[model samples]
Target: MDALKILIIPGSARDGSFNRRLAEFAARQARAAGQEATLLDLRALNLPLYDADLEALSGVPAGALRLQQAIQASDAVLLVTPEYNGFPTPLVINAFDWLSRIPATQEQPAGLAVTANKPAGLLSASPGAGGALRSMNFLRQYLQMAFAMVVVPQQFALGRAHEAFDATGALQDPRAVQSVETVLQSLARLAQALKTA
Candidate 1:
């Protein structure tokens, strides 16, 4: 089978975001597992808040268009988000909201071109004990119900994220490393199955 093309997106744009480190680690794991992985930082996208009127006047932002194209090219996606008051970061919500507003074209169905039937995996990191698990749960449900994404059951939430990684961005906890590998493997299998189906 052809290698699964995976996209790893981190919700936070901060220079020292633990979620970004987690995304980088996941990308490396995916590559070592013989899958092709790309890291997409939300900061670089620089998307504005979602506004219907603005969208109507100016059309979809270039960032949303780029995100859609990235999703269309990938076989699977891994979303690493930082929890904000038990919810996903504003960047994530805004980006998805913009993507969901896109009208359908003859080539693609209406709305959610970025997520429809896409195989997705969720991961979150936080300094608190929750490890952003609530955000992960919310994203899993939202992505599955709202966008019809095929979200893998295998997910990871790294609690105490500030101390979870080493100097090289590698997870210090052996268990965390194992958990990430499991999620990647599950996502790869799901993506491959969908590709051959």
Candidate 2:
């Protein structure tokens, strides 16, 4: 099987965010599994808030365009989200809001180039017991609406995330580690299948 290209996107912009740590861990695991992984930090993208008026005036920002290109080039996407009040962080939502805009082209309608039929996986991390599961639900629905092929029904949520990792930033629990690896492996396998299909 050929190595799949996977994009890992962390939804949090805060330094030392648990979600970012989880994304990094997933990227490492994907590479270890012989897949090519790119970890994207949304904070570094510095995207402007999505506004139709602003877009009409200035067009999609360069940052957002770069993000769209990255998504288009990847075989699969893994969203590592952090929950805030039972929903995904505004950073994640805002990024997608910009990504969902239809481009001024006829070849592919609007966001189709970035989202349509693209394989995606959802995961979440939080300091609470729920592990951002509620947030993942909302994110999954949004991705489905955008026409992404969300292949994994068995989503991974890291509950009590603070205790799940160690000083070295590795997941401390064996079971948690196994779960993460399993999800990533599933994503790679599905991406490979789709690539050859």
TM-score of each: 0.96, 0.93
Model 1: lDDT of residue 94? 88
* Candidate 2 global lDDT: 0.84
Q: Model 1, stretches more than 4 Å misplaced? A: 106-111
Model 2: per-residue lDDT, tens digit, 1-197? Answer: 66788999999868889999999888888898888999988777788888889999998776776678788889999999988889999998888888777585765446656777788888899998889999999888888876565657768999999888888788999988888988887877777878898
Please estimate how well model 1 matches the true structure, expressed as its whole-model Cα lDDT: 0.90
Q: In candidate 2, what residue range of length 10 has the lowest lDDT sum?
A: 104-113
For model 2, the superposed segments whose C-alpha errors exceed 4 Å read 102-109
Best-performing candidate as measured by TM-score: 1
In candidate 2, position 146 carries an lDDT of: 65
